[model samples]
Target: METKLKVGDKVTCDKFASLTHNFVGSIEKIYENSAVVEILEHHKDDTVVVSDFHNRAVVALNHMKKISA
Candidate 1:
């Protein structure tokens, strides 16, 4: 099933790649299978990767869950 996510929506992304923990952010842009998330909250251990990506991450739609409120 496809998740109805949109820009400006708050979301959390499951860990992937070198990321050691999940993270929270807002949707900045959307793609066919992923969205660009602007990092708002994240694990301290992921600081390096989060910063490296300029506080943004391209997270797959399936890996993201929208925050209700």
Candidate 2:
């Protein structure tokens, strides 16, 4: 079993951008290509994360790519 999560895998989600793009909530549901991520907090710009592209909408799997520090 891998430490990271895969598609269709039930797990909790936490965003490091909780302070900025906090609109994303817990793991509500999973879709075919997109995960139905709920909105727990408030977010003005979801695209705050450069890795998330220019849209702060969907949290794609590739978005989980670790940013080199």
Candidate 3:
């Protein structure tokens, strides 16, 4: 389902790795079919090592769920 997301709204996003299945962050910006999620917290997934990767990522809107109103 298409969950309406807004900037600064807390949300959890689905990732490729099971361990990182739900990463928490806030919406930074919205695009056509996706939004930019600023990674704030997540499970320590060894398989998907993202130690050096940027915190911000563009994820599909369908892959995200609002955690806060």
Better of 1 and 3 by lDDT: 1
CA shift of 18, model 2, Å: 16
Model 1, span 1-69: residue lDDT tens: 456888999998999988899999999999998999998999999999888989988999999899953
Better of 2 and 3 by lDDT: 3
Question: What global local distance difference test value does model 3 have?
Answer: 0.76
- Candidate achieving the largest TM-score: 1
Clashes of each: 0, 2, 0
For residues 9-64, write the lDDT of model 3, one tens digit per residue. Answer: 99988875434556888899989889888888877762244454467778888888
Q: Where in model 1 is the C-alpha error above 4 Å? A: none
Off by over 4 Å in 3: 17-19, 46-48
- What is the lDDT of every predicted structure here? 0.90, 0.41, 0.76
Worst 10 residues of 2 by lDDT: 60-69
Candidate 3 — which pairs collide? none
Model 2: residue 65 alpha-carbon error in angstroms:
8.7
Model 3 TM-score? 0.76
> TM-score rank, highest first?
1, 3, 2
Q: Top model by lDDT, which number?
A: 1
